[model samples]
Target: MNTTKLNPPTQKNRLITMILAMFLGIFGIDRFYLGKWKSGIAKGLTLGGLGIWWFIDGALLLMDAFLHSLGKDSGFVKDARGQDLRLGLSMYRLKDGRLQRDWFSS
Candidate 1:
């Protein structure tokens, strides 16, 4: 097994994902970027009208990002640069073979 560690996404990406999730979560765009293809599609099919549950989900995603940016561990997957990697999208590969998805690249 290739035990290669997976990196997180950049701050910019995280913000983008959060914004999309908040605004278009009803369409599952956020979920799609989060690697939750099934859920994303389901949300889209249902028009995200699954009652208050979908609203709560959006709130949680925003909170997660807020917590992470506060220097607090969000208990989520982070890229090599310690940035939270959303899902679906791949970060840049570092020279050391590690992945980085940060706003600033070396």
Candidate 2:
């Protein structure tokens, strides 16, 4: 078995995901982060299913982000790029084969 320690994930920024969903949700940019392309496309194609789907999707994202804000995991899958989200400040990362804590913080 090729066992290796992957650096812990960046602290999945709730704010960033929420902001993306609020603005570019129609384009599924927010869904891109959660690796939810299927639903994202559906919303984008149906014009948010005449607004209903859009609202629901936004609400779900907001709820998940809020749950995560309480120092708890939202249980959502990791972002596809596994990169830092600009809106998700206070993120962490792996650098030099080690953990980079608070990567975006000053």
Candidate 3:
């Protein structure tokens, strides 16, 4: 039996993905950037589900980015390879106690 594990592919950039989704999401360029070809084609064909899908996609990306910045998992956005995007400006934190911490400000 094989006993080796394969490393996943590199994660995609969140900023670029958000940019594409915000600007060209109607054509599914963001999905193509994430390597989701099938969905990309479908989105493009449907004009981003008559624009509803495009708006939802952009909103989800934004939410994910916000969550990531807070040191949380991205519940909405992920690449085709199932990797989280390199989003958010993770910052230095000051530990208030063993179970407490402050975000952004030191």
Candidate 4:
């Protein structure tokens, strides 16, 4: 029998996600920042459940950040800082020489 092992994806810039989740989760800013527009809108419509759901979400984001920081693949979205605006959502290098956006994979 032959078996193949699949590697998990890695997350980048988890610290920013955690911070956004903790401070602006009610507005779904964390989800939006993470590229989850649907979820972000839902969270925004709910007002984060008077802070309860937001707290939970923040905790989860923090946990995800911790795992990512430890070099563990958590399947979280990578936050790229500095990218060309013309690239529209795809990964691009900004004038400052920093990579931003994961870029739509073709």
For lDDT, the strongest prediction is: 3
Per-residue C-alpha lDDT of model 1 across residues 1-106, encoded as one tens digit per residue: 4444455343435666667777888887776776777777888888786635468666776666555444343435333345555322223323234444434434
TM-score rank, highest first? 3, 1, 2, 4
17-97: candidate 3 lDDT, tens digit per residue: 989999999999999999999999999999999999999999988887766666664557888978888755334322232
Better of 1 and 3 by lDDT: 3
The candidate maximizing TM-score is 3
Error of 2 at 96 (Å): 34
The residue pairs found clashing in candidate 3 are: none
* Candidate 4 regions with alpha-carbon error over 4 angstroms: 1-12, 75-106
Better of 2 and 3 by TM-score: 3
Off by over 4 Å in 1: 1-12, 75-106
Q: Write the per-residue lDDT of candidate 2 for residues 20-104, one digit (tens) a residue.
A: 7778777777676667688778877877677776677678666554443333333343466554332223355333455445434
Off by over 4 Å in 3: 1-8, 89-106
Question: How high is the CA lDDT of each candidate model?
Answer: 0.58, 0.58, 0.78, 0.57
Model 1 worst lDDT run, 10 consecutive residues: 86-95
Residue pairs with clashing backbones, model 4:
90-103, 91-103
TM-score of each: 0.57, 0.54, 0.75, 0.53
lDDT of 2 at 9: 49
Candidate 1, residue 88: how far the Cα is off, in Å: 19
